[model samples]
Target: MYIINFIVSIIAIIIGINIRRNKRNYLIIGYNKLDEKERQLYNEGKPLTTASNIFIISGILLIIGGILAMRSPVPNYLTIVSWGVFILFIFGGTLYINAEYR
Candidate 1:
């Protein structure tokens, strides 16, 4: 279970990295001409790229927690709860940002 959680955390980190990379690519690579609204959203999303940092940081913490759990036995329930908290935090932040910003 801990291994699975650790893998999930790694995936989360990868996702964050991908999003950050995509944002950079979008700016540097330059895409086809977008409508005004699309262009505005792209500009706005530039700021939102920082929002993905929440995922990256939380994922790192989860990875550390998983390692700790492995080295020094912790309660399984506690591990689950910790993982849930991070997931909830990421989801809630993403939703809030989307709702309020977009």
Candidate 2:
């Protein structure tokens, strides 16, 4: 699980860089669906890159937590809180991007 989480973290970081740079390949969060006008709006705003950063950070945290969980009996409270934050960030980022494009 830790290995998988680490791999995901790496992938997320790469995708985040792509998003920040506005590359079309391996685009995250349905960004490729944007039309010309929407693309302009996205470029004018920071939400797209913000969302990517959020995902990258979340993935990194998850990787760290997963590794810690391996050697010890991970505490329930910490796991729960981490998951909640992750979900909220992802949801908020998605909402921001969708609302912007819409």
Candidate 3:
């Protein structure tokens, strides 16, 4: 269990770093693809704002959960955190699909 937690923590850290590094690019691509009014609204904070917020929140939670799992017997928390990340992934995919189609 400890080893499992350690592996999960390392994976989470790597994932977090990669996602954070690319976030600006993601924002740029998403922003540029929007119409002027949509871009303005995104800049002002609306639906698009949630994307980064959710990603960051889920990433942080995953890291924390991974750490906690590594430190204790409660490794199941990492599973929950992983599920949250999965949900965010789905949400992001849906957003991309909607944007691409419309």
lDDT: which candidate is best? 1
- Residues 1-102 of candidate 2 have per-residue lDDT tens digits of 556556766777777766667744234456567677765655544665666677688787777666665666765555555556667777887777667655
lDDT of 2 at 16: 73
lDDT of 1: 0.67
Which pairs in model 1 have colliding backbones?
A: none
Model 2 / residue 87 / CA error / Å: 4.0
Order of the predicted models by lDDT, top scorer first: 1, 2, 3
Worst lDDT 10-window in candidate 1 = 24-33
* Cα RMSD (angstroms) for every candidate in the order listed: 5.0, 3.6, 6.1
Off by over 4 Å in 2: 25-42, 75-85, 100-102
Model 3 segments beyond 4 Å from truth?
1-44, 74-77, 84-102
Q: For model 1, how does the per-residue alpha-carbon lDDT over 1-102 read when each residue is reduced to its tens digit?
A: 788778888887887788786764242222335566765665556444655676688788788767766766565765777688788878777666556544
TM-score of each prediction = 0.69, 0.62, 0.40
Model 1, residue 95: displacement in angstroms?
A: 2.2
User: In model 1, which runs have C-alpha deviations exceeding 4 angstroms?
Assistant: 24-42, 45-47, 71-73
- Candidate 3 lDDT tens digits, 9-82: 45644544554555543443454667777655454333334444445555555566566666666667665666
